[model samples]
Target: MPKRKADSVLEGVPKLPRDSSIAHHTQADYIEVNSFVTATPCDHCLDSGVPCMIDRSRRYSKCASCTRASRVCKREFYTGREWDLLRRAEDKLSSDIEKNEDELDLLEPELSALQSRLTELY
Candidate 1:
């Protein structure tokens, strides 16, 4: 393929110095942008069923909704795989609880009989 010509608009702009403060500021800006991009909604926003909109101007801050409501912003960002694992664990626990409840129900008559015998002895 033939070489492409550079944009005229960018030709006049001077290259940034490697060790300059401007470069450092640019790095910091990148960090801020990455944080904003990767950040998930806070717990309150998730529970309230609202969109999590973080203020681009503020770094490491609460979502706009939480800020407006004056609520504590607690974030727990979980990946899709992590959420799936958590849900699976919860389902297992729920199944165990149901089994235990059924066992308890089956033992209720026996428990009543034992109590009645104890009462007679008393």
Candidate 2:
């Protein structure tokens, strides 16, 4: 087949730099969600450096120190296989977190009972 002419490129859309660490301007919500990976703390505890604590008995902000609330952690292109693996890992982590939350909910009443029993004993 003969070679075809290239189509027009987008204007003013600068190429992405190889530096993943470059800071870019974005709106408030977007900026809050994405930053240099090392600089962002657990979106959950807001720099507590601890994974967020979840109690079934308590209300949780969507910002729970869970991976779902965390950063995407990638800036460059990827192979299809690599992307599949990354997505699977992310999904597994998300499920694990949900499972932990469910377990906490299931145990809340038992914890309450134990606290009451201790009070009575004291």
Query: What is the TM-score of each predicted model, taking all chains together?
Result: 0.42, 0.38
Residue 36 lDDT (model 2) = 29
For residues 1-122, write the lDDT of model 1, one tens digit per residue.
Answer: 32445655467688865555554455444444544442466787678786676656665366655544556778877978899999999999999999999999999999999999999999
Model 2 misplacement above 4 A: 1-77
Candidate 1: list runs displaced more than 4 Å: 1-76
Residue pairs clashing, model 2: none
Q: After superposition, how far is residue 66 of candidate 1 from its true place, in Å?
A: 14
Q: Per-prediction RMSD in angstroms?
A: 15.6, 18.6
Per-model lDDT: 0.68, 0.49
Residues 87-115, candidate 2, lDDT per residue (tens digit)? 99999999999999999999999999999
lDDT of 2: 0.49
* Number of the top-ranking candidate, with TM-score as the measure: 1
